[model samples]
Target: MELTDNLKRVKKPDWLRVKLPTGKEYVKVRGIVSEHKLHTICESGNCPNMGECWGAGTATFMILGNICTRSCGFCAVATGKPKPADWDEPKRIAYSVKLMGVKHCVITSVDRDDLKDGGSIIWAETIKEIRAISPETKFECLIPDFAGKWENLQRIIDVKPDIVSHNIETVRRLTAQVRIQAKYDRSLEVLKRLDEADVKTKCGLMVGLGETEEEIYETINDLSNVKCDVLTIGQYLQPTPKHIPVAKFVHPDDFKKYREYALGKGFRFVESGPLVRSSYHAEKHIF
Candidate 1:
């Protein structure tokens, strides 16, 4: 009975249904991604907007490697021992962005805990290389916390990606169960440091993970206190049965309320909805 009730609660709602993308542009982008051996969180993370982004001829490139060190419950990215950081990744990513001719590009990566510098050196080089070839293009880097090493974090800060993002993933109450090894306060510190640098800082959190409304507002208050520039709130979908099950499907109306509240708290931009992810509608947030 308990299992049946749980299954009922986890079923996806109608609003969450989406058609898979198909078009010449998506196929073209897929070929480019495959040809370059580039990794994209859009596919690795199992983001619902991957198809939509590809259909428009853009993609969020993932570096470091496809394998992640952490085992976050809500993520679809594979986890295991990752390969050594590839030195040539920056040039390949830059050329791919140039070839696609996108006005803006978002870059993200899996957690690489094995690295000494936490892959910060490659991160800095990637941004620099991208600027060298596509001087006109903009960058949004959704980065890791570097295991609380502020110096490693600074490498990314010095490069000056248009926006720096690191998702808290969920409210404080669910952080341990959802993000596993990630620390709730530490994620806040990551955003706080970015905010202090006077760079536009952003972070995302997923809903429908059994957190209360008050918990959500409390997370918002914490972000506001840190003066985070942008906030993205999205519904949590179960990537697999072995992963954490969805608590419930949050309604669109609740997402609207979240948007209004976040904006009131002084967020310059907020993307709140069922399909929103860390990089969803990323091009608009650069403003």
Candidate 2:
């Protein structure tokens, strides 16, 4: 599957349309995010479920800043030389988590390939501070691959989030075109290593990236081989015109099939739909 395929974009179906976020809870969440100078993937990645998630009083926080180093074609997060790592981010995130009083919090970050630790130190610190402030809270870290460095990955492993997630993004054939700087097998390795260490490992898949159903099944099997416990499969909406074009708008029935297939492959939990993302209904996965 080519990245742009001559920029021939597919029409977005009605299933992809979403309402804007409103309500008191949504405003409160937004205010807290702004007050602390925090960033969220919900905003940076142009997630369709932001209104639903934030209006319900939860959000997937992005750490290590909004600026990203890797310029993945599918991502909406800005790519450039990121500002210097902020060591104090953990405290603010911890405070925010406590303020929200959420029992299950999902945390993710933009790729910080420019950093020596690839932002793993802050990842660990954020988790630690959250635990310190909100001991009862269950945590999930939707993380970068840390440039495939074992030691940096180990920092997140050491923190022992309730569930550790890294997205496979797209299948093998489309990986290079879609992910650019990411290697297909290396992502599997990251999940495998996390599962080996007894972490509840999870990964997300985006369909509609010109991948065949056979390829999707194959990717599910590969994740199963690594003993990944949770899986999410969703349609890939082109974040912007400049990003990769949507090759297809997968049907909801197909997403159901994908869920059943993943369940049969032994995933403890699966969320498959047009709107699913890595952090979609993340709290349920830990249960």
Model 2: colliding residue pairs? none
Best by lDDT: 2
Write the residue-wise lDDT of candidate 1 on 9-108 in tens digits.
4667899988798999999999999999999988888889878999999899999999999998888999999998899999999999999999999999
Give candidates' CA RMSD values in order.
2.0, 1.0
lDDT of 2 by residue, 137-214 (tens): 998899989989999999988888999999999999999888999999999999999988999999999999888999
lDDT of 1: 0.91
| lDDT of predicted model 2 | 0.92
> In model 2, where is the ten-residue run with the lowest total lDDT?
1-10
Can you give the TM-score per candidate against the true fold? Answer: 0.97, 0.98
Question: How does each model score on lDDT?
Answer: 0.91, 0.92
